[model samples]
Target: MMRRPGLALKLSVLLMLGVVGAMVVDFSLTSGTDMDRARVLVFVSIALAMALLAAVVLDTLIIRPLVRLSAQARRMEDRGYAEPFVPTGLDEPRELGEALEHLRQRVLAEREELQRLNAELERRVEERSLALAAAQRALVEGERLVAVGRLGAGVAHEVNNPAGVILGRAGLLLDDAATPEAAEDLRVIMRQAERIREITGALLRLGRPSRGERGAVDLAAVARSAMELARHEAVARGVTLELSCQASEVDADAAALEQVAYNLIRNAVQASQEGGVVRLHVAGSTLSVSDTGSGIAPEAIPHLFEPFFTTKKLGEGTGLGLAVAHGIVRDHGGTLTAENLPERGARFVVRLG
Candidate 1:
């Protein structure tokens, strides 16, 4: 690239040319007259002073201001809009500086807008990522539940026959026992057999086809029935049952829906502390049961609706309640979801249409 001469150098060259011209003119005019050497020297000195003054004026009004303005533009490119560009000097340079300053302001505004848009895009992407992950988890869970149901149905059928036989034989032995210890032993065997039968019954229920006679069933009424059934347990536990029902009807099996409501309410009652509130709200084909207990454990939430997956103490729960409820809701072409509340406790929502 060719480097151009700066304003200072160009002005200096012009001033030197003018001085030479003045000296030449003095020599030419003096050639025809008796001009003294002192007089010629004085005239040359005056020309030199005028050139110096012109140089000073140009530097102050044009050269120095243009240099400052150029430096300011470079700084603006490097450092963003942190500094203001102040216009200075004579009309032409000042106008140019003002134009550059205006450009800096516009660029700054555009840069800020671009930054805001980028931030918004990032936030939306993050949200979509989270939603996609949740959807994948739900899909896997649904497949697992289907497999569990098929297996449970087969297992329950196979186990039911032997369980009944054991109970029958134990009962006969208990009646024929000759000693108190023998009778007691037989009783224990019968009791265990009875428990086995109960377990098998629950498994069958969980695995059975949930679709039943469909009718217009008012969810509020079903919720009210469940609330009544749980009223005694709630009272015994010193838990308050709060019901807010709307006359919302859904095409579903009344008995199955009631069972779902009952199971959810029962679980909520059992989970709550004394004096804790158990809220049952039914509105517009949606029923939610919320309990003011310690929220469900995060690790246990995924398996909450899986058969035999219980958080309750051993022997206290068969763990088929939620599984059955989920199956019923699914068969009704609805969804049953459980979530921990932000403040405290857990909420189970059943949405039907």
Candidate 2:
């Protein structure tokens, strides 16, 4: 490839041409005159002055400003736009410097703003990720509870006929007992068999859809009846049941609602410590049972409404209470949810729409 001549080389060539032309003119004009020395001096002086002027102009207009601008560009590349460009030299160079300065400032401002926006975007992403994780956990728990309820329903169905037969025979034996002790023993067998029937009934309720008739039902009255039904259990457990709200009505099956409230209140009483209180709250379209006992176990919360998933000791509970209650509420076009209280115990809320 051919190399181009630099500015300094071009200037030097022009100066040499000027000197040669001046020498030729002097030789021709002063060859017949005694002013040859004067002509030579004049030519030399003019060439020297032209060379000096060219050097000064090149240095002032191009070389010095170019060096400064290069240094400024290097500083910006190495350390970023920490300082503004200071213009020097001719108008063109000064305007170029100003333009560069403006661009640097704008770029720096945009970069900072972009950083801020990136930080905000990251925060939002983290929040959404946490929410998604929580939702996934809830969905998994719901699926597991459904699976358990289906299994429990099948087992309960298989055991129902045998339990009914035992209960029937025990009732017959109690009536024909030869002695008082035999009658008492037979009575005990019948009572135990009745408890089994109750459990199987709850399981059937959980597994099947409600066929109860719907009517305008007063929730407060239902709550009262539920409280009365649970009164004996509460007294046995030494727990107090309290009603804390006025009348509320909904278009639902009164028996279903009553059963739901009875199950919830009974479970609360059973979970409570002796002398603890279970409060029943009935507001417009909502009923809640809050118990003053140790809150539910964190690991058990997911399975709380599942049939046969009980935190109570074996033989003390059949675990179908909340499952049946949940089904009943759902059949009434309502929602039932349970949560642990912050300070103590647990709360079950039913919303009728």
Candidate 3:
């Protein structure tokens, strides 16, 4: 590609061409003049002066201002908009420089405003995240205390009956020593103590935080067992039990999974009305227990997973079943949620990851 000449070079070339044309015209017009040589000398001097003047004019008006503007642009690119463009020269170049300066200031202002907005956005996000985390922690702690209170009450009630039996039998034995009835009394005492031990053991197991003895557990089998356990309760309530499950496996404790399934199924059965149906559906690692009965109260949905927040009658439920099931599923890296069905009744879904 042919390189384009700069302004200065092009102007100088035009000046030289004009001078040569003038010399040719003068020589042609004064071809017969006796003072031709002097005339040529005068013409040469004037041409040289004009050329020098043109060079000065071009340098001052065009060349210098453009060079300055280019340097200012480079500096702005390298060091940012700290230095402002100072207009110089007369006429067009100066006007152009002023326009560039105005544009630069506007851009800088917009950039600063953008940075401020970005900082504000980040601050708001962080604040919301912290607040959300704190709220979640408080909610979890509150639920935990409620669970403890319910467990304590249930334990006390369960232990009280067995304790009374043991104490009464011991008193009878003391009153009738060496009697044939004393042996039977001793045996009854032992049986009541064992019952108390079993109740405590169950509580301990439910309260345990860790998922016990992980293995590849067949979810279909667990669902079957849970259904079988709840079958009697469903029958007693005149409710039908329906199961739809595909064979699926998960890394979990078989006993823990069984407990979760049983608790959920039993709750569904209890929630159902006479002649209603409780359906258990399992697909992959997800299980849903749904019942055709009155849907859950909207207000109670939020506290459904909380301990001692049951809607059942006082004697019918201790309110710890769902809480225990929730904890067990959580320990196994899963989630359990309850939601009222669209048409009627409620559904409990468990998803294991």
Candidate that would win on lDDT: 1
Full-model lDDT for every candidate: 0.83, 0.80, 0.76
lDDT of 3: 0.76
Lowest lDDT sum, 10 consecutive residues, model 3, at: 16-25
Off by over 4 Å in 2: 1-158, 179-181
Candidate 1: segments with Cα more than 4 A from true spot: 1-63, 90-95, 160-198
Q: At residue 332, give the lDDT of candidate 3.
A: 83
For model 1, the local distance difference test gives 0.83
Candidate 2 backbone overlaps, count: 0
- Per-residue lDDT tens digits of candidate 2, residues 1-353? 95343212122424321332222222343244557657666766687677777666766775577678878889877888888787777788878877888888899999999999999999999999998997787567556655665676687799889999999998888788999999999888888888888887777777663668988889999999999999998999999999988787789988888889999998899889999999999999999999998888999987787777887788888888887887777667677888999889999999997
Best by TM-score: 1
Per-candidate TM vs. native?
Answer: 0.73, 0.60, 0.51
Comparing 1 and 3 on TM-score, the stronger one: 1
**lDDT, residue 72, model 2:** 84
